[model samples]
Target: MSKRMLALACALALLLTACNESARPQPSEGAAEIWFAVGTGEDGGPLVDGGGAVAPEYRALPDEADPVEERMAALLSGPQSAELRSPFPSGVRLRSWRLEEGVLRLDLSEAYGGLSGVDLTIADYCIVLTLCQVEGVEAVDITVEGETVPYRGRKLMREGDVVLSGGEGEPVAITASLYFLRRSGGLASESREVLVTENDTLATAVMGALMAGPRDQEELYLPLPEGTELLSAAVEAGVCYVNFSRAFTEGAPQSREEAARLLYAVVDTLCSLDQVEAVHLLVEGESLDRYGGVPTRNPLEKDYEMAGEEKPAAASGS
Candidate 1:
């Protein structure tokens, strides 16, 4: 035979083989169908079934274990109680937790009505003490409804009002007005001015003075309704005169008792300094009517009322 004829015959043989292979039956991609056998007592050996064979047993491997969640749950939910309750009236709920970057991200419910300016410092202490006790959690990032909690002044996760104690010493006392940033997504925070005092006890005395004073200025202490800026302090005629700005009486707000409390907060703070026997309120270098009903004294009470006197002016400063 010619070489060309032999090559054509070989090509035809290869084509036939390919066609035959393609036409053969193939397995379906779907799951295998299961079959069961029925007993036929006639065999008497054990029991014969109509089917040829039985299906193989399916045993799935065990799932991976999660120790973090279990441990955290045990730590947070004490053996006595299951749900954690807030000390404040606001009903805050803790939802989920995740550890990342050496910090615990605690997801909370939306029901958390944040604490106000004065209450914020106390709230921070509560949250930090509770979460820090858990193992492997040194810091926390609070999230509400899947977003980071927002603060008014700074980052909520790491910053707060109350300053932690340095090393082994007691925590120092400080006070500041708290604000919240809704867009931030965590909690309200505040920036405070640190007042240097003689000791821890005296530091608290200074904080009390700041809390009772106006938001804009730190030096002057005035009645709640008064917007007075404390200019200077002088001792004359056995009285410590506190000179203040005339803007003090534009549109201040406070009852007679509230005004008296402000007076006492100032007097108490000043009295802590040696050689100050009495304090006198002065606006723009002029003496003002008494606050509440009586003159300030030790353990000052809020009963100051003028004799046949009219209501005081308001504060205008923002």
Candidate 2:
């Protein structure tokens, strides 16, 4: 063939080869995607939004010796892309990890112990969302240097707790009838609408509102003392477990009447919800046998009359 004809044939052959390569299926074997916190840009992604948002990146899973461990290492190594960043702070390597009964417990180095508030929350859910993709990991329990944070609002982080809403998730607004002590004596209800996110349950929102005290402080008495933290709150099998920090007990009222009001304020507020048949009060996760004059060894059912015109007698006799 002539030189011109040979050149044209070679160009046509190259175009065909390029088209064939483009048509071939992309390889996805031995690979999985992991999430990372968004470093910049408008973030409405999963995780508790207070400027803490996350996005995902596709990466190859290391040789499948231990899938969970491998995936966690990949997350710790940081995202390959420039737009994403690891939520874990510097030097926060995984100290230990174990899976039991669908719960994945990850103990990170002491560097992680310094995080609190929104930063801690974001870092936690970042690990949760990334690791939960592995089989048998229904929830994540993260600790710093082998100990749970005493003041953490939630101990168990689940996939459902945060979602990839892509900036569309809206806060749920509920008008809860929160109970507070009446200045004169008995308890009274205040209907206030509070916004709750996917990360917060209705019980938690109500408990937080009660802790914030009533809007009309002059007419109502705040049962929960100031600086009391709601460690965690959840309902299981018709019982709402409300865990508070030690500050709750230390700041409790000394008078029996005042104490009873404080205890029942929490009980009645939680029981108002249909899912909670009774309330179980705990100070730092230990069941309180008695808080002042109230017997709380077992979950206490709500007292319909506690909020009546007159305060009912204490649940337990002094």
Candidate 3:
């Protein structure tokens, strides 16, 4: 065959192959592999073990900005009860984090400085190690309120900096404004901080924590009845849907004043979430018409009258 004819045939074959490949079906994305640097071992030193995302888009490798906030949320929430304590201190928040080229820059709130000495160094390593888990990030630089600061004797921290926390140390704690009955009369709120273990969505975790009730000697009250379980919870379109077990109704307060206070506790706590501006209480996965004399048929917003004050505000996608 002529060289011209051979060349034309090869070109035609290549085009057909390309078309066939393009026509093949594509697979759905799976959960991405991720790791969270935890303070484990006796020393409370920075250590990391496997953790990952179930979100479909993250099934495989992921981009830096894709879920930086979610990871930050997990970090701030503290490790599981059995895991080593959180490296960060209470009140600290990652204002924002970004990656450019190979460097990851973190802008932290003033609360980030609450730690000092070995604890402070471990906290910095935790941030660097946790973020470096991302495929592209290799180094970390942190700033407080836009000003650069020193960390671990150097301004730059890298992926391998994580080490076991040493010496006797306690875990980080985060506070929440929980509403409870005032021994004298009406509704009131108190700030309580603990090393939280969040196993599900933030909305559900908040509800679950509430149901656990107050700890020993805690001045606050947890009015929710015993055996009540957070079947499931989700926040969408600015409303939190909380489905509770039957124990919720059985253990609920009958008096109007106490009932309103109890209901508002769930409402106010959920509304604290950025996505939840209101809430719908449910039992066994279905909405209830009424539970505490407050109208439940409709999605409920904060009752400033019962809450004792109006909610403050929003944004802080932090």
Candidate number achieving the greatest TM-score relative to the actual structure? 3
Q: State the lDDT of candidate 3 residue by residue for 111-204, as single tens digits.
A: 6654432345446655664567666888988888777753335677775543222122222223444456655555555444433231244455
Cα-based TM-score, every candidate: 0.34, 0.45, 0.45
Output the lDDT of residue 177, model 1: 37
The true-versus-predicted C-alpha distance at residue 223 of model 1, in Å, is 6.5
* lDDT by residue (tens digit), candidate 1, 12-64: 01000111223322334421111111111212111221111111111121234
Off by over 4 Å in 3: 1-172, 215-219, 310-318
Better by TM-score, candidate 3 or 2: 3
Q: In candidate 3, residue 107 scores what lDDT?
A: 90
Worst 10 residues of 1 by lDDT: 10-19
TM-score of 3: 0.45
Clashing pairs in 2: none
| Reference-based TM-score, model 1 | 0.34
Worst 10 contiguous positions by lDDT, candidate 3: 10-19
lDDT of 2 by residue, 127-166 (tens): 8777888889999998888899753657898888763332
